[model samples]
Target: MKLLLRRPQQSDIQALHQFFFHVIQDTYAKEGIAELVDDQQHEWELKKKYVAMDLESRGEKRFFWLAVDEESNKIIGTIECGEANEIIQQTIKEDLSYCPEIGTVFVHPDYQNRGIATLLVQKILTTLEKQKKSSFCLDSGYKQAQIIWQKKFGQPDFILEHFWGTNNHHMIWKRALPFQL
Candidate 1:
């Protein structure tokens, strides 16, 4: 499939919401947390509101990019930049103090392991580098995402054991922006 990454537009709101819900629901199901599906749906709705607010602000406070499958004209992935969440800020403390965050990364389940996410990360890193940012922080509460982040960035700088529940931890990573992608 031909993939294209571009800034999100007003018209893409509904599709973006569906994309987020689909990915989140699939992830929880795969993790055997189908019982949390309703919670995930609620979170997605809140996230949609946040994205809409960001869009209305014209990206002054946040920026997002969507990966589209050119053949089907559908959104398959997304990445965004913004301030670190409260959990990350509290855990990373002085290390990530005021650093901008790179997050909201998700790819359609069908497209996993196909380098779409890597492309999104590289694109965000390149964008940050161009803006003269020296580093950024990312946090994950999902085990699958934490594993992927560990492989890409080494062990997290901070870990909150059993943050969500027993055996479900949250991790925060701080990395210097590479000069070259």
Candidate 2:
């Protein structure tokens, strides 16, 4: 399917919110953390706010990139570059004083494993490079995402043992910018 990658628009807020809810719900269910489902709406609202802020600011501090299916005109994936979250900053011990993070990388479950995420990441990296960034950090706490990141980025620079729970950890990877996908 043809995909279009572009900055988020005002009209895409609801769609992005829905995507965030479902993806997070699915992740929680898959990880057997069904209790976290109750937190999905709160997280979605925060993400929606962030998206709205990004749209208004026009990448002044944070930028969001959305991948839309050209055939159906539906948002299929997204990625963003912004100041790193506190958890990530503390884990990586950098505080994002200078290094922004590439995050919020998500793809619809039906469209995953189809290179949508890879495309979104590549687009975000290109945008960061264009902004003169030389490197970025990526973090993940989900098992499935951790596997994919390990494959794509090799070993992480920081691994928080049991950060989420016993046997569930968070990892952070730092990559030099302007590199190929």
Best by lDDT: 1
**TM-score for every candidate vs. truth?**
0.92, 0.94
Tens-digit per-residue lDDT, 1-181, candidate 1: 8999998899998899999999988888877787986789786986686677679877656778789999999999998887777887787667553477888798999999999999999998987877777899889888889989988889998989999899999899888877343
Displacement of the residue 151 alpha carbon in candidate 2, Å: 0.7
TM-score attained by model 1: 0.92
| Per-residue C-alpha lDDT of model 2 across residues 24-126, encoded as one tens digit per residue | 7877788788687556667677677778779888887779989999999999898888888888777766546557788888888899999999988888878
Q: All candidates' lDDT scores?
A: 0.84, 0.84
Best by TM-score: 2
**Least accurate 10 contiguous residues by lDDT in model 2:** 89-98
Candidate 2 error regions (>4 Å)? none
Give RMSD to native, each candidate.
Answer: 1.8, 1.4
lDDT, residue 105, candidate 1: 91
